[model samples]
Target: MLFPVLALIPATRTEPSSLLKLLAGEFAAQVAATWPEPHAAFLAAPAARRHLTCLALALGRDLPPIAERLLGGRLRHAIRLVLDPAPSGLERLLGRLGELAWDAEDYRTLLRLLAQRAPAKVLRHAQQVEPGAVRRLAGLPEPMGEAVGLALELTAEGVLVLREAYDALRLRDGPEAADVAASGWARAGSGKALFEAVRDDLTPEPLAPPHAGTTHLRPLRSKAELREAARRYRNCLGDRLSDAATGWQAFYEWEGPPGAIIGIQRDPIFGWRLEEARVGGNGAVPEAAREAIVSELALMGVHVGRSGWRLERLLRDDVGRGYRYWPPSQDVAEAFGDED
Candidate 1:
């Protein structure tokens, strides 16, 4: 008997009718509060249970508190009963309710509860429901903008259904549907553009490795060696200079022996200057070398305006005075000296 009743309602049926009977039964039990007697009655007559369930669901806010409590419990029980692989005595009682109608609020509350408590059941039920209702329900407001956006995004196909609804509403009302459609289109376009911009911003650029034939150097053998080298270079230069001061600098030329270059120079104000030095191959000199130079200098704590020729010349002069500190055998002075 239970099997026949379950079979009567197709799995796809989403109308309020299918569950109406069960809902009504629960509501009646709540209203009566007699407990065992009503429960026995519900079990005895599955058709009666079905009618009661439908009535209860339709009652909505009109239902008393006792009805709500009883109905809630019964709803939970019906859900569990439906989960059983084999039809139970309560199965027929679970059926009988035909198609049910749910407004936006009802759909939202039901969906939330389903997502939290019975996700699988919710999905199954959604499939059974009317496509139009499902589409509308999918568009219901979400607590978070992202969630709403995602819902709209996932149900893009449902837009047609919404459009139909809009049309119907418009016929019944005025230009409400047209306005909604326009707003939806505008928002979607803006969101898409914003998403693309963010995506582009996050995309990484391809990194090119150092050019072939470029010289490279490791740092000094130890911090002590580096300090001692700095001190010695400073002594040779005989000047107190800014780190940007090219008279004294440290760098590894990517030519010849490929090792450190330390410069010692005399400054007008500072008696001695020590600086790190670097020698670049012809390839290192760019058409916009000044821009590159300024960019590199900025990275090294040197502040200079983009078009400051005076500052550029000063930097070039200081860099020229910086000497290669690597041993003669390792120096790129000869190999990398070409002006080009």
Candidate 2:
């Protein structure tokens, strides 16, 4: 009986890295308390590999749980964000806000904003908001069924306009208009140059150059460039500022003739892949341009695949519809028939 009891006992698991806990600093408890066990264990597993980026994120003290699940729970892509440096908008926002304002709801809202629309706008508005802005700006219960339904429900820029409008209204329409603006975000309107001057946030940005050769991808570095591409290409790409700004989706212009815009997207399931290739008025790419784009992206380790298995779905009377995307090539890059 004693021998059997001794055999029944299992060995204890080893603790995670001591460095991870130590570097967690004042936020160690919050980190230990908040992140799920697997993520915590994952964080701890890389004791020797812990570099500045990991340390930076650990100190950030407020990022998403479950979601930072970058690239199959591997730190390779996640750290490359810090290494090669693309705009990881959430981290930048949290760093701006500091630890005190790091609420989970705010994190979720910012994440939603970064993932969906107006990431640059979100970053700008958050930065400019008055002290205690983080607490103030986060719309509770997250307004239903709206993109950027922020601050009495408006885009980040729209919120600023509302604030400006309310300030003007308060003086003209008495304290009522002013009161809301003072307490929180607000709105007002002017009739026929009632206020002649409000400078827009627009700033000059360098334009993407025409490609010397077949064409290569160039990043849309500013709101000006994005608007210009939208105007020049006449594509349905004007609204993706947040997606690009946050590195969830990125917009690039093919630097040559006929003017095409390229969109590269990173998804949990589909790491980095060419999401769209559009010319003027959302037109399809010419074969030469498309092939060139595909070839270049392949060099960068991006897949330029299109609907192969998905097309097979209709043939077999499958139950699911493939998500719509601008097909890169007339020829299927690879056949991965959609599984219903």
Candidate 3:
């Protein structure tokens, strides 16, 4: 157990080279003493060879001749382990590598490690610190393009847009626009021209005249309608709501009223539900009634916020729920009589 655990620590140290050598010797002694022959054989086995090679590399010393001899028949397994280690082991190896002077192979190895692990910050640092090395590694004849491309694709939508533009304008009508668009497209693709064209065309058409019999409805129309529409729209998003809901819930949970239950109320005309929570500052409704209201609103896909407040206010005043009064205490019924 101790040998396995101690094997994890990289042999490189902050001390002088001599001290590292001493430390490595001590570690080796511990392994020899504490680990049985079977355990040593297992470590030297084809399946475990890479871990051992990594251990030797990290130690900055050649493995014992005996260990090397054991590895001869397990070259493939050793190669695989060196190629991929446990996360902790990989991290340790990287940290050890960082101490060495730059080498092309070392840079390539680091690039491969980053591509596999998606260590974005480390990769960025590596790119910045050794740009030429990164470029060389990128140009290497390897499947590294897949990893590099994936990273770019994940974070560079702007680059994609540029590529699309270049593709779109590769051939076009007018020489001037075509020239400009073609240059831009070469930078990305012809899609850029098409994108620009679509954007220009999509500029809002003059509002069509309302039909003679049609009564004008405002874009969102009323606050109630807006709130309901937002709610319904959000519900259609389903699991997509998890992120939005989490953010909203966290905000309201801390800043909004205590004991406030959120809810929704649908607009009868638009079939949209107004959703919101009942807070203490507002007139008191029974806990059950508030919950019921909020639940109905949520089921109708309403979330509580500014729009919710507007809807709630509208419901209370326009629907006559606002003027309705409840006794604060059942025991003192007359004390709160006629309260709005």
Candidate 4:
């Protein structure tokens, strides 16, 4: 389950610190105390465990403690998905919620709504409903509660769903929907009007992000294979290949040896638009070369965007830097010599 929050905010690749793991463990335990079934099931899955670990780490201390159980499975599943890449608007909305000084009750209400997978209709109704309804549901005062609740619901469904919802509402309710838009709903970034500005035709479906709990690197057998891969990529890109260099320059500016090797891998953290690659040789892969490779791939539309591959250093002695090794680890290498 990917967090709907991943769509908006960028996830960091840095490994979780011990402190964060501690916090996540405590939170998981608390959630278990209230709703044990989901928590136990969550612990059973390694990938889901990693999701919780990463999110708890990324969210850091800002992650509010779990005080009450609100349909634990949905909450736990959503929480796991929240670590993976998700809809941008939902991610931003979740970020705002994290930033707030949440009380126990606030967490309870928000978690409940998330568990329900609040529909766009909830948001539309939220706007039309009286102040009492807003206050009762969101616990915030009057219009603010209505706005936030609606935004939260739309975010849960993702930006695309939100757009469809708003479009349907406008077609059906007309002024009622307009009235909601006019009533400072746009003040919250999740609101319909604000979302419209950022909305584009790009859909998230085509982007093939790597599966969770997988290695980022894909090894090449030889420089010949590498060149062939590059050529194929260039051919796929055609004229857009020119933009590849520019795309590469946007992220890195360092220089390195010409013969130095590099390995492009999908990022384990962040969105599909971001990546992490291994740079081999005496020093890190030069910015110029990185620019060339990434620019071509990006231009070809192989990656999520123009600037996606994040570069890293490969240890000088690491033979795996430029070669294929199934299982991609020493355990496999020990079982069957390093080379195929």
Best by TM-score: 2
Regions more than 4 Å wrong, model 4: 1-25, 28-107, 114-140, 144-340
Badly placed stretches (over 4 Å) of model 2 are 1-215, 306-340
RMSD of 3: 18.6
lDDT of 3 by residue, 1-340 (tens): 8999999986643332332223233343423332333334434334234334434454444445435442565444444444444333333343333322343344445545455443434454442333333443343222223334333332245444434443444333434554453333233223344344433322222222111111111222222332344354343222222223222211111012233322222333324333333334433444444444444344434432334334455556435554543322331221112142
RMSD, candidate 4, Å: 25.5
Candidate 1: worst-modelled 10 consecutive residues by lDDT: 206-215
Error of 1 at 79 (Å): 21
Report, for every candidate in turn, its global Cα lDDT versus the true structure: 0.35, 0.47, 0.35, 0.35
On residues 153-184, what C-alpha lDDT tens digit does candidate 4 reach at each position?
A: 45333444544544554565575644464344
Q: Which candidate is the best by lDDT?
A: 2
Runs of candidate 3 with Cα error greater than 4 angstroms are 1-340
Tens digits of lDDT, candidate 2, 67-179: 24432345555544433453455434433543232333444444444554443465645643222333334432122112222442334554455455555655655566345
List the lowest-lDDT window of 10 residues for candidate 2: 194-203
Q: Write model 1 residue lDDT over 1-340, tens digit each, in one string.
A: 8998988875442222323334333344342333333344333444434333433444342333333243344544543332333223223323422333333344344334334322323434342433343353345322112223333344445444444544554564457534543344434444454333222222222222121212232223222343444464343211222221232333222222322342323333433222224332222222233334334433434333222332344455444467322332222222222131
How far residue 279's Cα lies from its native spot in candidate 1, in Å, is 23
